[model samples]
Target: MLQKKLMLLGGLRYLLPVIEEAHNLGVYVITADYLPNNFAHRYSDEYCNVSIIDKDAVLAKARELKIDGILAHAVDPGVVSAAYVAEKMGLPFQCSYEAACILQDKSLFREFLTEHGFNTPKAKGYENIEDALNDVDYFNWPVIVKPVDSAGSKGVTKVEDKSKLREAIETAISSSYSRHFIIEDFLDKVGAQSSADIFTVDGKLVYATYSDQLFDPDAANPYTPAIEIWPSSMEQKFQDDLTAQLQRLFDLLHVKSGIYNVESRVCSNGKAYIMEVSPRGGGNRIAELQDMATGQNLIQNEIKKALGMPLDNITAPEYKGVWCNYILHSNKQGTLASLEFDQEFQSKYIRDVGLIVKNGDQIVPFTGANSSLGTLFLRFDTREELDSTLNRISDYIHINLR
Candidate 1:
């Protein structure tokens, strides 16, 4: 039998598990991106140096390679390109190229939600600063300004004062590849927002889970999720409503089978809003953490779906215990000194520690997902212990720097 070939669009460390899964299934893996030294490239069977965001370039390479399947997985920028290539080559994908474009671009997504009568924040997308500045009155006060096509909360600013709107727009445009930005009314959340990966099969919502998306107020970017706790504290009624809404959305978009990183919140206005739903696995190892908490391997199932292989029966993940994925990051830019952990806390709570940097390596403030140091997988016997420990997380874990 001929070996199946799979071309992955990005070489970030998040794709490592995807490559591992494909290899376990006896599939040949090709990692492609502009950077050759990316961590995942070291593990892939082949390396192809092509810019992933450029759909035409990726399509050319995929055609030349005659790959059997392709996927972007946790990489946000490459999702549209992957869909485009899959559509052009008549391969399997989560959605059409047009659907991917709408889902990936914040502006387009907001428009879609509003047009479809989803409970979305009032938002507008702009390609120029002058246009955004002129329409400040369109949004309610305390609006959020962000890049229309960027992910991991890069260049997101909360503008309480109208005077700071221009600076916020500049920051957003700087982070955007298309030089576009979005200004949306901030939905004051009732509690910690929910962000997790959910799966659909043939446009039917099959499996869903939500996490408490926690953030560090002191971090350089407070919008970037610092910790994620499984089995969200959100009320069951709200979760069910969100699930139904998501299924409706999938049906409307004709979404195919795959995993989607969904962000939702129950607002102070007594309504639930789906903030973002991108057709790819979320960064920060969200799917991996889900696997640990629920005993479901979404990573492997996603790989199977990508290759057009039969998928394992995916269902709602049942949490075995309270779990948290602590994102390791520094609040300041400096040289790494050492990581300090309280011995008793480490022995009891810490399940696994994955560090990307070593002592003496240079470190930066946590501005976005790209600046994260690593992740600490933790498990607690009860919700009370998890809440208490996380509230005083600094007492147990410290990232010392020079």
Candidate 2:
């Protein structure tokens, strides 16, 4: 029998890899979340109906079970709770509790970065409409408003007109569980944005990698990531500089060991900027893709740390080829009937496709990350081939929303 028990926060299917890894390591796996039918529960040894965002409740459950470690992968709301329980229990922790709280709160994170001399955008946070309205003119013309602590790009609004300020603030607050929001100047990204992961062991950075975050400007929310490509098309020199800056940030935060989701970009000002850095595996199996491209097993390492085991070699990522992950979305709200792709897509471009929704399942209008109904992965032989295909992907495939 596996004696060590690992408690995972949230049973989203994204954690299936972590669950499988733990099972293989002979570690008892348990899942917790408000949803009982999260599918991943079927693979867990036991399940608990606790709200992942409620730290005290989850910590109580963890104590009752006497779990050896706690992890919240790819779920933003669960990160703070998992870190809190680990800190209180004296178990292996990703970072100090104080640092984890700052990383989880968008406003605090931005403040920390700005104070530390990192390349970031001017930003402000507010909890109410009046306060945001009063400070609206403080920024440039075009701006972005979003929930301070929300994930999956929910409640993010692009406001180019002052008349839309109140509406944008309301939308962001509605999406935020904390009822807090942040407003920042909309940066003109030099290339595509970057959404990737960095791993550190004992306050020493071991792995740092990034990808080009592609988006569907025609989608309900233009800011939501549509596709992300590994081996970013960014100039190699820019990537190198960003990597160095992140290592310094990791050390400043005293991050000992954990997987972090980082978003950055080269802006129109001809400088690379670090937009966001959160301590958790990102949504959409981003780290999983990196694991596939490189030989590192980040999923296994995350679980291993919670169990107080030595981490796997995260030395450096070795890209075998160019790869991309696409989020399948629908432009209309209706039942999903089918996703049809041209013969060329099936025969030449797409490596694999996965539909999170079943035939006849409800498909919501493409809005944020949550609206994605499926995933598409691609492997291209050359950078030029990858760029040309992404630029004209929609012409080759279509999702039918009945």
Candidate 3:
């Protein structure tokens, strides 16, 4: 029998686990992206140099390689391209190419949600700044400006004054590949935002989990998620409602078996809203952390689904203990920095530390997810201990610069 050939878009470090799982399954893994120096390429059976954002280019390469399946996984920019390639090749994919395009673009996604009667923020998408300025009155005060086609909060800004709208628009346009931006009413969350990876089989929701998504106030981009804790603080009633709504949305989209990264929040208006739902794994190791907390291997199941293999039984996760993933980052630019952790804290809570940079490496302010230094996985026996430690995180962990 021929070994199954799997092509993965984007060579980010997050793809390493996928590569490992593919290898274990006796599949030939090919990592493709424009960058040849990406770390995941080192582990893949082959590396293809092609722009993942260019669907035609990726399709041509996948045809040349004769791959059996393709996946974008944690990389957001390549989700549309991967879907296009998979559809062109008649391979297994989570959703259709049209569905992927709609989910990947913020403006299209918002319109779909509103049209489907789901609770969504009032938003407008614009290709130029003048039009958005003219329609400023359409939104409520304290709106969020963001790129329509970017992720990891790279081009997100909270604007209360209209005078700063142009600057924000420029930032959003610069970050967007399509040079488009969206202005939306910012829903003031009643508690920490919820983000998680959910799974569905043949358009039926099987597994769902939620986390408390936290942000660092001192970071350059305060919207970027700085930490995530499992077993969300949201009321059980809201969680249940969101899950039902999400399943309905998936059925409307005709989604197939696969994993999705979902973002949601309970607003101060005494309502719940689904903010974003992308058909790919979330960045910041969300699936990996979920695996540790629930003993469910979403990564492995995702791979199996991509390859058209039968998936293992995937059920709702029941977390054993409180878990948190702290995205390590700095607030200022510097060089030759050494990370410090309190000995007692490290011994008690820190389960693993995955550092991306060594001492003497240049580091910059935490403007986006790309600027993160590393991630720390922690487990606690009680929510009180988790809250107390995270509230005073600065006292336990420090990033010293030379």
Better of 1 and 3 by lDDT: 3
lDDT of 1 by residue, 201-287 (tens): 998888988889999999988888999998899999999999999999998899899999999999998999999999999998988
Candidate 2 vs. true structure, TM-score: 0.96
List residue ranges in candidate 2 displaced over 4 A: none
Write candidate 2's Cα lDDT for 1-402 as tens digits.
Answer: 449999999988788889999999999999999999998899999999999999999999999999999998998889999989999999987797789899888888889989999887889988778988998779996999989999888999889999999999999999998999999988988888999987888878788888989888788887889899988888888889998998888789877887889998998898998888787899988878888778788889988988899877778787878988988887788887788888987788677776678879988878887789878778888889888987887787777777
Poorest lDDT segment (10 consecutive residues) of candidate 3? 331-340
Arranged by lDDT, best first: 3, 1, 2
Please list the residue runs of candidate 1 whose C-alpha ends up more than 4 Å from where it truly belongs after superposition: none
**Model 3: how far residue 76 lies from native, Å:** 0.5
Error of 1 at 279 (Å): 0.7
Specify the poorest-scoring 10-residue window by lDDT in model 1. Answer: 298-307
Q: Report how far residue 256 has shifted in candidate 3, in Å.
A: 0.3
